[model samples]
Structure formats: C-alpha cells, structure tokens
Target: MKTIGYQEVREKLLAGEEIAIVDLREEHIFAQNHPLFASNISLSRLEIEIYNRIPRLDTPIVIYDDGDGRVERAYTKLREYCYSNIAVLDGGVAAWQRDGGELFIDVNSASKAFGEFVEHHKGTPSLSAEELKAKIDAQENIVILDARRFDEYQTMSIPTGMSVPGAELVLRAPSLIKDENTQIIVNCAGRTRSIIGTQSLINANLPHEIFALRNGTIGWTLAGQPLEHGQQRSFSDLDTQIDEQVKQNAAQLAKRAGVKQINFIDLQNLQAQQDKTTYIFDVRTEQEYEAGHLPASRWVAGGQLVQETDHYAAVRGARIVLVDDQLVRAYMTGSWLAQMNWNVYVLADDFAQVLVETGGWKPATPQIDVDLFISPDELQQLSTTQNIVIWDFTTAANYKKGHIPHAQWVLKADVSKLIQQPAFTSLDAIVVTCGSSLLAQYAVPEIKTQLKSGQKVYILKGGNAAWAQAGLPLSQELELLSEEIDRYKRPYEGTDISKKAMQAYLDWEFGLVNQLKNDGTHGFFVI
Candidate 1:
C-alpha cells in the first residue's frame, strides 16, 4: 500500500487541503491517543460508515494504526470498495509522536479544542457552580438553560434548569426569557456545549447577563450541589416576529464567523463538484428530522454536529452545509464549524417542502451472500428445538433497551476475546444480529473464522428490529459479555454517578487546553 509520512499529513492539514486521516482502530483504543485531526473509523465498520462520512470516493484518505496490523487490513478493504486515493501513515502513532505531532484523547477533540480556543480568545464568561447555587438560594431571577439533548437534560439537570438544547438556544431562548435583566445561565454535562451555547447567545446580542455554568453538571457535583433528576422543562413555541428576529440575528452571527449563506442553486452546483467533498446535514432535533428533512440530508442535531464534527463529517476541509427551518440552528452550528476551520455554509432558503422521508432511518444492508442465514421465524423455531448462541452487535444502550429474548450483547472489537470464554466454546450454532442486520452481515465473515469446523454461524436476517417488527417478544435483561466502554459515559447521561467520577471528568477536560497547546496542529480560530 502507498504510505505517507507524518510531516506530509501535518502540512496538508495546516495548508487546509482536503484529507481524511482515519484511525483504523476500535473507538476505545482510538480515544487513548490520536492525531488532532484524525477521525476513528474502525476496520469492522469501515464499509458501513465510510461512504456516508467521506462522500467523495476520491478524497485523499490516510489510514493509521498504533503498531497494530489493522491499517493494512483497512487499506485492503478500502481498495476492494473502490476508494481511489488511499494511503497508510508511514509509522502510525509512534511515528506521529516522534515527529512532534499532538495526541488528543477522547472522541470529538476538534470540538473540545474549539471550545477551549473560544474561552481563551473571547474570555467567555462563566459562573462557578457554587456561585450559581448561591444565586439559586437567593431566589435570583435567572434562567438556567441546559444546552444538552432533551434526553440528557431529562437524566440530570441543575435545579430549575430548562431544556433549550444546543442550536435551539439561539432560536428558542428569546421566547423563554421575559425579563431582559434576568441572568441567563447555559450548561451541559461538561464544558463544550455550555461554552458554545453561552457564546451563541452573546454573539446574537441578547440583552441579559449570560454565563456558562463553569464545567457544567460536573462542576455542580464537584461544588457539592445536588442535581435534579428527570426534569422535563422544554421551550415553548415563539411568535412569527420573534422567530424572524432570531433568523436575522443568526444570519449576522454566521456572517461574522465567515459562514457562507448558500442558495439551493449554489448547493446544486456544490454537489456537482466531483473532486471536492460536500456533506449536507439536517441540523434539527431528531423528532423534527424524522418528521421531514431535505433529500440526502443526514439527520444530526445542530448541537451534536458542532460537538462531534469529526464523527459526522470525516473528510477534513470538506464543504459542509447545515439545514434547518428557522435558519437559526443552521447558522448557529455553521458559525462554530467556520471557527473550527471547516468550509461551512448555512442554507439560506425555505425548502421544507423538499423533505422526502418521514420516519426512522433504515440503512440498506450490504449484499453479502453468507453461507448460513436464517429468517426471524426460522430462528424462533430453531430456538425451541436446539441450542443456538445469539449475539447482538447493536450498541450497549440499545441492547439494554430491548433485544431478542435470549440474545447476548457483544462488542465487535472483543469478538476474538469473547470466543475464548467457556460458554462460547461448546456452541453448536452462532447467530449474529444488529439494529438492522447490516452490521451483523458485515461481521459474519470475521465470526466464521473463529468457529469450530463442525459449528455453524448464521446472520439473523433483518436483526432485532425485524424481530420486533414481527411482534416477537423482546427482553430488557442485560446479558453482556464485553464491557460497554466502547462509548464514553457522560456525567449527565444517567443519575447516581458519584462525585468522584464527576470531579475526574472535570479534571480531564481542564487538561485538554494543555493537550491542544502541546499538539499545535489544530487550526482553530476564534471570531
């Protein structure tokens, strides 16, 4: 495979050239140490995720692994998929470190770095959780807006905090506030969204004393403040005039951030550019996106799009256009993208009628002809007659929610390790499943390699979703063989997290600024 050195990759990023430096390792391992701009697309999920992320097959991609052999395997797979320009990183993570390259921990490092950059440059105002609690005790006329997702807000929030979410802060906050003199406090589980949300309102010229709850809920816990659980306060609808004003303010903010306003005609022209990669995203809430969205627009909340830009748009230096009905959400999100040094745009037209889908997304399963495949009905019958080991490849959270009655949750990266367990050794047949069966289908080939000669492996056609659709009984019992560390647990995700964990999370975020300074590769700017 063709290989590129660390210096060339660093230079390309600094020069703003389009490239996708993909780390071909599992999510948990990739989080330990990776280049500032590198996105983790694991070898197992490469085929399933790459096309949607990179878009342009010809976009230059540099794959790397930390002394592991995954990069070569990933390169071979990319070639089979017809990716035109692919290369291996010359010496992987070790070489990157030797070349004075910065290593960032955690997923979505760019967004985190940008938050620090904003705080550094703009001196984004913040109130310590202790100070905020004192204000609360004093019965201060303040509105605490939780800028996390509705679910996250429901999980845990500061007392009396309302769920305004990310981009909605700009579009909905004005309606939620009646007194111009009222103090406005924005927060998330941690720092990034809180800082961005507070700054968004400030940039929009809100007439209030705005401050981010410093370090968010973690800070609150660290300050010995009790959190309210299962809060459900959401924003109400705004008047036409208020919405129009919000749009106007958002446009101005986008302009200041150098975010381009693109018409549908311009978008069409952008889509026609074969050499360049363009990602179109509907940056509305999941409910709104499920109701309707622009054709070919991926549903990513505006807040998440900013918080996890690397996850949504893998191609660095690609053109990104964000879509929303009121224009506020798109502009608010695009502004951050622009500051993060992305070629970003906000759609400047009302094209709501162009929405094509109106339900949950159903990804088309890959057409892999596995030797053994079983229908949901057939599997149900077989379960009654013989022993069959069913493994669900869906996320741990999803598996916990509901799955086939006897299915066990398995991490794709831990499959090899799992096969060594005593329970798996004597299995007669193995059945693999996922949210839709697409991920399961992709996994069958690797799973087959681990099976004994007499043992058979089968893909559950249609997966758990199909079983549920067929009115099959589902189970909520958690039967997990692999630890669920693939996803980082947010301090605000669920209730009952100890103060120690919260403080540790705060400490980790506090150290990120130093990490960014040491890496010096991120081209983040504050406007």
Candidate 2:
C-alpha cells in the first residue's frame, strides 16, 4: 500500500484540503488515542458506512491503525470496491507520536474543543449545581431547559427541566417562558451542549437571564443533588409571530458567525463541482427526516451534528449543506459549523416537494459471497446436534433487549482474545450475528483468520432480526463473554447510576481540555 507521513497529512488539514483520515480500529480503541481529526471507521463497518460518509470515490483518503496490521487489510478491502485515492499512514499512529503529532482521546475532539473555545471567547454565563439547586428549592422564577435529545432528557434531568434540544431552544423558548423575569437555564449531560445552548439563547437576544447548568447533570449529581428520572416536560408549538422572530434571530446569529446562505440553484452548482467533496444533511429531528426529506440527504439532528461532527462528516475541509423547513434549525446548526471553521451553508430556498423518504433508511448491503451465509433454519437445525458457537456483535443494550438463544455477546475487536478461553477453544462451528447481517459478514473473514485450521466460520443470514422473523426463540438474558467497555456508558443513560459514576464522568470531561492542550494537534478556530 502507498503511504503518507503525519506531517503531510497535518499540513493538508491545515491548508483546508478535502481529505478523509480514517482510523481503522473499533470505536473504543479509536477513542483511546487518534489524531485530532481522524474519524473512526472500523474495518468491520468500513464498506457499510464508507459510501454515505465519503461519497466521492476519488477523494483523498488516509487509513491508519496503531501498528495493529489492520491498515493494509482495510486498504485492500477499499481497493476491491474501486476506491481510487487511498494511502496508509506511514508507521501508523506510533510514528505520528514519534514525529510530535497530536493525539486526542474520545470521539468528536474537534467539536468538544470548539465548545471550549466558544465558552472561552463568548464567556457564556453559567450557574453552579449548588446555585441552581438552591434556586430550585427556593422556587425562583426560572425555567430549566434540558438542551439534549428527548431520550437523554427522559433518562435523567433536573427536577423541573423541560426538554428543548439545542436547535429548538431559540424557537421554543419564547413560547415556554412566562415573562421576561423568568430566568432560563439550559443543560445537557456534560458541558458542550449546555454552553452552546446558553450561548445560542444569548445570541438570539432573549430578554431573560440565561445560564447553563454548569457541568450539566454531572455537576448536579456531584453536588449531592438529585436528578429526576423519566421527566417528560417538552415545549409546545410556537405561534406564527414567535416562529418568524426565531427565524430572524437565528439568521442574524448565522450571519454573525459568517454562515453562508445558498439557494437551491447555488447548492446544485456547488454539488456539481468535482474538485471538492460536499455533504448534504437534513438537520431536523429524525422523525421529521423520516416522514420526508430531500433526496440524498442524510439525517443528523442539529445538536448531534455539532456534538458528533466527525461521525457524520469524515472528510475534513468538505463543504457542508444544512437543510430544514423551519429555517431556524438549519441556520443555528450552520452557525456552529461556520464558527468551527467548516465551509458551511444553510439552504435558503424552499424544496418541500423534494421530501421523498417515508420511513427509516436502510443502508445498502455490501456484496458478500453467498456461501459465507447460513439460513436461519439451517442454523437452528445445525445447533441441535453440533457444538455450535454463536457470537452476537450487536450493542450491549441491544443484546440485553433480545438476542438469538445461546449467543455469546462479544466485541468484534475482542474476538481474538476470546480464542484463548476454554469455552471457545473447542467450538465446532462459529456463527456471527449483529442487528443486521452486514456487520456479521464483514467479521466472518477476520473470525476465520483467527480460527484453528479446518475450523469454519459462517454468518447467520439476516442476523438476529431474521431469526426473530423465522419464529425462533430469543433470550433476553445477558451472556457477555467480554467486559462491556467498548462503548462508554453515559451517566445519564439509564434510570439508576451511582453518584460516584457521575462524578467520575465529570472528571473525565473536565480533563479533556488539558488533554487537548498537551496533544496540540487540533486546529480549532472560534469566531
């Protein structure tokens, strides 16, 4: 495979050239340490996720693995799909460190750094957990707005917090506020969303005192404050006048942030340009996007797009177009992207007729050898007599919900480690499954490589979903063979988390700025 040095890649990013620097490791490993802008596209999901993220086959792409020998395999696989311009990082991540390149931990380093930059530059107002708790106890004339996804708010929130996700804060705030005397407090699980949400209201010139719940629910928990569970307070619809005012306010903020507005014609012309890569996103709620959305537009809610930019748009320096019918969501999201130094624009023209999709999108399945797959019926028959081992590659939450009976839960990255276990060493045949069978197919080859000679690997056709459809029994019992650390458990995800875990989470987020300072690779500029 061809190779590119760290300095060259760094220089290219600094120059704002379109390039996709992909870390070919699982999410957990990628989060441990990767270049500031590297997007984690694991080898197992590369084919399934690549087309949506990269789009242009000729776009410059760099793949790296921490000398784990996965980069070459990823390069080979990409070549089979006819990707034109691809290179492996020279000496991988270790070489980058040796050459003084910055390494960032956790996902979405750029977005997180930008959040810090916003607070630093904007000096967004905030209230400590103690202060907020005292206000709540005293019954101060205030409204607590949870500026996260509805589900996240449902998981955990302040005593009387209302759900108004980031982009919706400006649009829905006016209707929810009783009077100018009512103070507004916005919060998220941690810091980024809270800061951005508070700043957004200020930018919109809301005539009320606004403060972010400092450190969010983590702060509340650490302060020995109780968080309410399953709270469902949300904003009602706004009047036409209020909606128009929100649009005007959001537009002003976007203009101040140097966010550009593009008409449909300009967007078409922009997409026609072959020299640059462009990502078109519908930045509305998933429900709205599913009901109807522009053709070729991917669904990423405005808040999540800003919080997880790397996951949605892997190609740095690529042009991004944000679309929404209400105009406020798109402008608000575009404003943040512009401040983060992305070449971002909001669609200015109405394209309501283009709304085409009516249901959830299913990713196109990659072409895999049919022989590698076994029918659900066949697996059921084989399992009766043969000593079959089934590995479920789905998320821990999904595994807990339902999985094929007797399937062992394991991370794809940990499969090699499982080989040393006595239970797996004597397996007669191995079957792999995920929510969908696509990831299972990608994993089959790797599983085969690690197996003893003559040991066979097969994918359960259509995965667990198909097994259920075939009237097969599913076990809700958890059968984990690996530690459940592949994905970080959010302190606010479930109903019951100890105060100790919440404090630890806050400590982790609090240290990220120093980590970024030490790494020094992130090229963030706040406007």
Candidate 3:
C-alpha cells in the first residue's frame, strides 16, 4: 500500500472530493480539534465495533491520528476483512494541518453531536444536572440512571441516578424507566460511553425515549452540580434484564467475532478429522467447567475470554471452539473473537450427546486446581519483588493510561516475538497481566518454553489492577500514550516486513493523496 501526505489530502478535499476523514485519537484530543469532515473512533472502541459499523468488505477508507500509526493497523484490519482500498494519512493530523486543512475545535467533538442527535430524534429521553435537581426539588416523574461501573457511580452521582453500566443498559432500561411517561436519562463519567449507552438502546430498537445525560457527569461537575455518596441499591427486575442482555449480547458478539456454533453431529466430526488442528475451550466460569465439561477442553471463563484468548491460543492458525451451555456467554465471547478475526466456534444443543458418543479423549495433564489461582494482593507482592519481571500483556493504550510501576508491555498476540528481543533473553522471571489474571495464568507455560533453555517463571495473581488497588506505588507512563495504538510494527506474514513496515508506515503518512481519496463514512465519531 502507498502512503499519502497532508498537502495531498487537503488538495483532494479542496477539489470538492467526497471523503470520510477519520480521526483515530483519544476522545479528549479529538474533542479539541479535527478536520471538518472527520469523525472520532478511538482505538479501543474500534476493536469492538469495526465490523458492526462498517459491514461493507471493500469500503474505501482513510484513518489517521495525531501523527501516530493507528491508521496503519486499522488499514491492516480492513485488509483482513478483504478490504483492499484502505490507506493511512502520512504524518497523521499534523501532516493534514501542515497542508492547511481546516480544523474544528470544541470541548467535545463529533461524539457529542451524535449524542445530541440521539436526543433530537427518537424523542431520546434525557435529564440534565439542573433538570435532575429541579425534579429532585419538585418530586417530578424522572428517573436517573448512572450507566457506569457501580464503584464509579457510587463515588459520585446525581441524587437519584442508580448505577447501571453501559453493558446493562438494554436489560435494565424497561424496569428503570418503567412508566413510559416518566423521563429516563442515562449518564456516564464522560461522553463516549454515555453516548454509546444511549445509542445501544436506539440500536436495539428500545421503545422508551432514552437519552444520555449530555456530556455525562463531567459536564455535570463543570456545571457545579452536587453529588451524594454511599447509597446502596437492591437487585431489581432490571438486574434480570441486564443478565439476559449480557448473555444475548455475548452470543451475538461471539458470532460477529467469528466463533462458530457447531451442532452435536458436527462436534463429533471435529474429533474424527485428525488432520485439522483444533482446541476446545470451555468458556464458562471454572465451576461450570468442573461440574462436567468436554473431557479435555481448556478452561477460560467467558468474561475473561477476550483478554485471555491470545494467551491460550498462541498459534495463529489454530481453530478454537468455545463450549458453554449458556448460548449467551458463548455468543458474547465469540463476538469479540470474531472482530479480532479469530476462527472460533460455539457448541449446539446436542453438544453433550456429541461428547458422549465420541468416548472422550484423555487429558494431557491434570485439571488446574481452581483454588490455587493466586489472589490480586499476592500477585502485586510478587510483581514488586526485583526477581519477578511482569510482562504486562495489555493493550498499549490501557498500559499508558496507568500500570504497575515496573511492568513492561508485550502485545498479547505478539509475545513470541519478545523472545528474540535482547532484553527478554536476560529476564530471570516473567509475569503476565491483561484485563484480568486469566491471561497471566495461560502465559506462564508459554514464556518458560520461549526463554533461553531454562528460566524461573511466575505470574502476578490478579495482574496490575490488583497491584493498583493494593496501594502499591504506581507509575503513569504518559509518554507511551503517544505510540500508535493500531500498528504493532510487526513484519508482514512469512517474511520480515521491518523495512516494508516502515514503508507502509511512511506510505500511510506520505500517501495523504491516496487517503483523502479513500476516506468517507458519514456517521462516525469517537467517544
């Protein structure tokens, strides 16, 4: 692929060429200023919703950030989907700006506009901090929903907003805003999630008029709204809705992510096909697996699958079949896998009979003692010791935002490449961490095998989150935030693309002429 520069992009746009300029920066940065036609799509959100938003296989696209390489990775992902007409803006937005492209600035970018759009249409319901206060004062018919994590919602919230995380909004919506006449407003700490939350309802075709609290709690804070703390909540009908929605969303997501759902007969056939390389993953919680699962399957709880899939399925071409009685769990996990372009599968209704007829294979080793899983505090202590080297296999963005004091990040899928690095060979012990501890548990054996002939190895119990929560010293590696989120800088398949990677990167930057021609997706935004 060739690269394009900012001058070329501007020239093309000035020529009145229709383009979809995508700003792949964090929400805060994009909110400051971006091209007039550009939309926000943060790296993290892109991971989850790419396929859903852009279903066309060969949509011409140009992606860029503030001079970072995220656009390159986005380009690669599009290619994986067989979309060839993709390019990156060389030198990113800096190059675009240098060429005298018009830039737009505001406290919130296009994401806020999207939120406002939601509010305008669908009669999307919303309650501002002032309105909520007025309702509280007048005892009006309005219900406030805080669609963030419980802890965060608990720490600060509108007097009436109840904690209802984004993932749970669909399930809880009906109950929270039971009376159709009652206004329901959802808010999050910031804008993206709140917009996403409100939008999810719109996407699901929910009946109630639901709107995100404009600009979320941050806006509320800036407006000098007061908050109350420490109010407890009881499980309500909304909880059931949340649980069901989680499962349903999980199943849909898994399918979208490429996890195949196999019927009983097909599963049995997998064992008979000796030539194919495959692994069975029981994605239910550990307890469900132990209560009787496919005889030799590996256990990776569904909630942790996205964070841990790369660890357990290290071989790129391997086929993975996730088994869980609950279809929802299977699908949810599968959705993320599908987006990552992994070959994944889910079991069908006759899965049990299929296992029985196959006369189950033998285990390669004893089942892992679930109890032996290390606690987060213990993991933190181990990581602090000089003897332990933590391979913090988290997304680079999350790692930069915050991480354990001495952790080193290795992308989950690219851990093998670390062995070739000079520093990796000298490490005495390694620990891995992702969103949860499951990835670290799966990484121990792999790192030990890759290290020079012999090296002691250990894993942080609950990983970095546990470390931070334990009041241990933490370091914020803000410098790392500048790295391109999408580009892994890896060589293309088969041969090293070190030079090609550089070229591709340069092309992404320098080929602005090409990017401008490619860019066009009207309704995109970063939150």
Candidate 4:
C-alpha cells in the first residue's frame, strides 16, 4: 500500500483511470460532496460488506477520509486482505481545494454547479418553483416527484407532488411518469437524494432527461413556495384488496417453506400454559423498533435472523414466533428458520399490537421448507435497487476477508445486539447470506418474526464464496470483528467451533422457556 497525494488522484480521475474512489464516512457526510465516481462504504460496516459487494482482488481502489484516522485503519485492513492496489487521498478533499482545484458545489457545498449543469446540458431536465407553480396553475404536463419517505410526503409537500421513496424509485418510476415526454422533477427534504435520484435515472438510460428539483423542498420553501400539510390519504380500496392478497400470498409462501401460522391469543395461552421455553423474535429493523415493537421481543432483522439464531435463541427445541407487518418477511424468514429444527410460526392476528405490547411470542407450529434457494447474482441484482440489509452469518474472519458490499456486520457476540439500533429497524428489505446458505436457511422462520411492519426478507442465493467466484467487487482486507472476537483469538487459539456443538447448543437453549416463565419473562427469548 502507498499513500498518494490529492493531485495524483485528481489527475488519475481526469485521465479516466478505472479507479474506485471509496468514501469511508458516515452516510450523511458522504452524501455531501463525494466525487462523481466515488461510492459509499462506511468503514464501520466494512467487515460484513466487503465480500458480497466487492469480491475482486485486482480492482484499483483509493479511499479518502475527512482527515480522520479511519483512512489509516482502512489502509491496514485492505492490505491485510491482500487487495492488489490501494492508496489514500493525500490531504483529503480540503487538500484538493488548497491545490486550487475547483470544487463541485453540490447542495451541501452551496455552489451553483447544479444550476450550471442544467444550463449547459440544455437536455438536463429541470423545473423551477416558478415553473412548477405556473404548470400547477395551468394544469399542464408535469409530475412532481417527492422522493422522500411516505411519512414525510404526508407531512408536507407541493399539492401536486407524489410520494416516491428513493429505493422504490426504480420499481415505481414507470408508474409515476407515464409519457416519455412528461417532464419529471425529483425532490427530497434536501438535495442529496434528489440529485442521486435524477442521476440514477440518467444512469439507467431513461429517455427523459432528469433533473433534481434544485435543493428539494427546502429550496422550494426558501423560494416562497407555499407548502401543503396534512396530506395523509388512505391506501386505495384496491390497496385493501392488495393487502389481503399479500396476506394470502404470504400464507402460501409460509406453507411452501413449511412455516405454520398461529393467532396472538393462542400464542399468549401457550406462553401461559406451556412449560417449555419458547423464543420470540421481532424481525423489524432497528428504526422500526424505536417507532414501536413487541415488548421483551429480541430484535433481529428478518434477513439476519437465520444467521444469528444461535446468538439469541440457539436451542433447536425453542418455540420461535415470527412477527412482521405483513407475512412477507415472516414467511420468508420462517422458511429459512424452519430448517434449523425449531418450532416456528407466523403470527396471523394482532400483529401490530403484539409487536407494540409484548414485543413478540414463540409459535407452536413447526416449519419445513421443501423448495427454497437463492443465487448470489440474484441477491446482487436485488441489492442494486433496494435498501437491502444483508447479513453474512459466517465466521468473522471470512467476513473480514470478503463479504457482501455495504452489509452491516454482527459477529457471534455482537449478533445479539443487531436489533438494538435505529438504522437496523428502518430497513425496507433484508437478505442473509453466509459462506454457505445453510445457516441462513435454517434460521429464517424465527428471524422473520422480528421484522419491522413492512420489510421484505430474503436469503442470498449464493453465499460469499459464490459471490467471490462471480467476479464482483470484493474488498482485499481483513479486520478483527470486535474486541471479543479479537480477544478470544490468542495467537494459538483456533477459529473452528464444531458444527455439532453449534447445533446442540441451539437445541439445548430451549431450556430458557421454563426459566423465562418462572421469572415472569414468558415472552422473552434469547435472540
């Protein structure tokens, strides 16, 4: 590894070198002024994310930090993993500016570059607030895309704006804008996502020249644009039918995976009546849990439940309850969890209250999946357009060697804390993959119950090995997963733990049922 100056990176970029510039910063910071070609991969999340996203060793990579020590740590990890070529930006973006290089004035930077881009390209799509008002007033051809969450859209927006969350844009764009000629303007609370959304469409080669509604709703508000509030609207009557259909579909999926569905009352009675320990899981993201979740329920993102069952509810005899807003996450998670030899069930009634009231429950029904498989390519493709949170439920060393790109890491010890955070709660989709799909497949059912209200859960088609062989991006580095994994590793201690003990421990953990009940923790499960 060699450290290069900012000027060299600038020259290489201008020279059109195929270099991958990585910003090792928090998402908020990266959203500010990242280079056009740079992609986001937070240093904190590196171990679990490297393999599945970036599997190749030979890719030229340069990482930059905001003068933080993270750059050095990143350099060390890359070298440890044997990444072929790696370097750090000389002084950071500041050094680039001190060298008299021009800055790309994005929203956070407060420059006129976006307006300039709109002006120079002529073909670059744009609609000013004045123009938007004129069109709204005239009822002319225009569609205002509020590219924020549905909740934000309900709070405030232009009367004509429609909510289209960023991740869903790819799937929903076609329906939002009908004609190729329809002028589209994307907006968020601010500019980052709005700009990214417009750029993504252009990258996808959409015929419409797209533009960010400069500065998003914030700019609109500053420009004296009247804001509309209290925009809540019920899902269409057809949406109700869709919800019902989705439920039925989920039930079938559960059946296919051999997951059983049970009612909340029955689950409660079992807690009161049964002497055996049961594990209850809340499969929602961390953000969702903060919003609300079942009391005493252990948090595990639905996708990661399969890989992390041992950390929380390791006993194969433990009854596992899977809960989610709809059954999609529950069923999907249950399919994989059932293979682990635990009794699993998808709560069919009072899900919202259960998640809020007791946290979650364990199901009496068992799961059996006759047909279930996913490929690495499919998981990668799904990741491209979704805010998919992947969990590589494998050894920490393997994760550090190479794992899914942008995936969050939870090693054996930290796995118990996976659902305790806010970010994990907000995820809309999840995929759990490992060195092999075996762990994820067996842990799904119990894990699915922990999902936030509306998340979709899945198993990565092929685990990390398949991902690496396919020639995708893989980080060339390894880092100690945590202090515990770091400490247990004496120079001589081995990484191998017998698979049988792992399985047996999982089964023995079922003893928690009686302990939790005697202690009045009926709804509590280890995971």
| Top candidate when judged by TM-score against the true structure | 1
Q: Hey, what RMSD does candidate 4 come out at?
A: 25.6
What does candidate 2 score on TM?
0.89
Number of clashing residue pairs, candidate 4:
54
lDDT of 2 by residue, 1-527 (tens): 78999889988987888899998887777877788889888875677888888888899999988776677777887887778999989988889889988777767777877787788778989999999989999999999999888888988899999888888787778888878799999999889999999988888888889999998987887788788888777773334235676679889889888888988889889989988888999887788888998777888889889988999899999999998988888888888998877888888776666676677666644576647678899999989978888999888778999998889898776665576567766778899999877776777766666677667788888889999999989998778987665564556456577878777666666666676676554555555
Q: List the candidates ranked by TM-score, beginning with the highest.
A: 1, 2, 3, 4
Better of 1 and 2 by lDDT: 1
Residue 4 alpha-carbon offset, candidate 1, angstroms: 1.8
Which of the two candidates, 1 or 2, achieves a greater TM-score against the reference? 1
Off by over 4 Å in 4: 27-40, 66-68, 103-119, 123-131, 134-155, 164-216, 229-527
lDDT of each: 0.83, 0.82, 0.54, 0.55
Leading candidate by lDDT:
1
Q: RMSD to the native, candidate 3?
A: 13.7
- Runs of candidate 2 with Cα error greater than 4 angstroms are 236-242, 371-378, 385-387, 413-430, 444-461, 469-471, 476-485, 490-523
- The lDDT-based order of candidates, best leading, equals 1, 2, 4, 3
**Comparing 1 and 4 by lDDT, which wins?**
1
Off by over 4 Å in 1: 236-243, 350-353, 361-367, 370-373, 400-402, 413-428, 448-456, 468-485, 496-498
Candidate 2, residue 17: how far the Cα is off, in Å: 0.6
lDDT of 4 by residue, 1-527 (tens): 47777667656644434455676765456645554335555565454444323434455677887875678777776776666678787777777557654433121221122222222333435566676677789976667776555666777777777765553343345556658787677876544456545644553345565667765565566567777776753111112222344345445645755678888887777566434445567665455555666665656665345533433442224467876664655665665456434568877786556656533332221233624455778877777777767766665656777777776544332333454467768777767667765555444543465777887667766667778888878763443333322212211012233434333332322232332223221121111
| Candidate 1 local lDDT, 1-527, one digit each (tens) | 89999889888887888999998887878888888888888865776788888778889999987665677777776776778899989888888889888777778888887887788789999999899999999998899999988888888899999988798898877778768778899999989999999999998888789999999988887777899988778884344235676678878888888999888889989999898998999888788888887777888888988998899888888999998877888989988899888889888776765666788554322356676779899999988877788989888889999999889988776675677677766778889999877787776776777777687888888888889889999999888987775566655457678877777666777777788788776777877
